[model samples]
Target: MNLAHAAPAAVDEGMTCTVADGWWSLDPERPSQPEPVKVVKLKSLTTGEPGVWVQPARGKLTDQQMHIALRRLSDCH
Candidate 1:
């Protein structure tokens, strides 16, 4: 696991996960970012099943943050 980097939780901004735990940018310095939402990812890299992507990201996400999160589910690895 990696410490989620300094980035914005904006879909169009960047998804610099290289390899990530989940989609929410966990950088505490970035309070302007959308809260991390707990969601079952359509793909889980570990179990190959859906669940909150731990080993991954932790959060306080919301519906408004969904756009930034959609990509997290598409990760088929």
Candidate 2:
């Protein structure tokens, strides 16, 4: 399994496991450190236009991961 780079915890900027016990580990400085609140940028599926997306007030996420998260959020309602 490929290990993705780990970002700092959004809440406390503490260390987290991106891929626990996986093949690789992320360099502490490589990933973005999240703030207390995070702003996400997304594209509209239908319009194919850029849109503003706000995350759940925290967490560092890549584009693909963010997309999946948004989909999961949409699914809940």
Candidate 3:
């Protein structure tokens, strides 16, 4: 899935997943610790799919960051 086209604004609007790509994640948010901005992969409540909910070690992601995170998560499958 090429996330280059993924819009940050769209993410902000709560469209977490792209079913066509079989992946989805939450927007990056500040954590309690001084760490990279984190995004949590969410499971499809209806499908019961397991999510790759690991916190990445990077700060404030650009569109590239989202792409990288998605790629890493995809590799785990």
Stretches > 4 Å off in candidate 2: 1-37, 58-77
> How does candidate 2 score on lDDT?
0.29
Compose the digit string of candidate 2's lDDT tens values, residues 1-77.
95333322231112221222211113365443322223344444454433224333323333222221222122111
Backbone collisions counted per model: 6, 0, 1
Question: Whole-model Cα lDDT per candidate?
Answer: 0.35, 0.29, 0.32
Give every collision pair in model 1. Answer: 21-56, 21-57, 22-57, 36-60, 36-61, 37-61
Candidate 1: tens digits of C-alpha lDDT, residues 1-77 = 97344432332222323224333556766644433343333232353332233223344443332323243433232
- RMSD (Cα, Å) for all candidates, in order, is 13.1, 12.5, 13.7
Model 2 residue pairs with clashes: none
Name the lDDT of candidate 1. 0.35
Which structure is stronger by lDDT: 2 or 3? 3
Model 1, residue 59: distance off in Å is 0.8
Q: Model 3 scores what on Cα lDDT?
A: 0.32
TM-score of each: 0.19, 0.18, 0.21
TM-score of 2: 0.18
Candidate 3 lDDT over residue span 19-39, tens digit each:
222223233342233323234
User: Any runs in candidate 1 off by more than 4 Å, and if so which?
Assistant: 1-24, 29-57, 62-65, 68-75
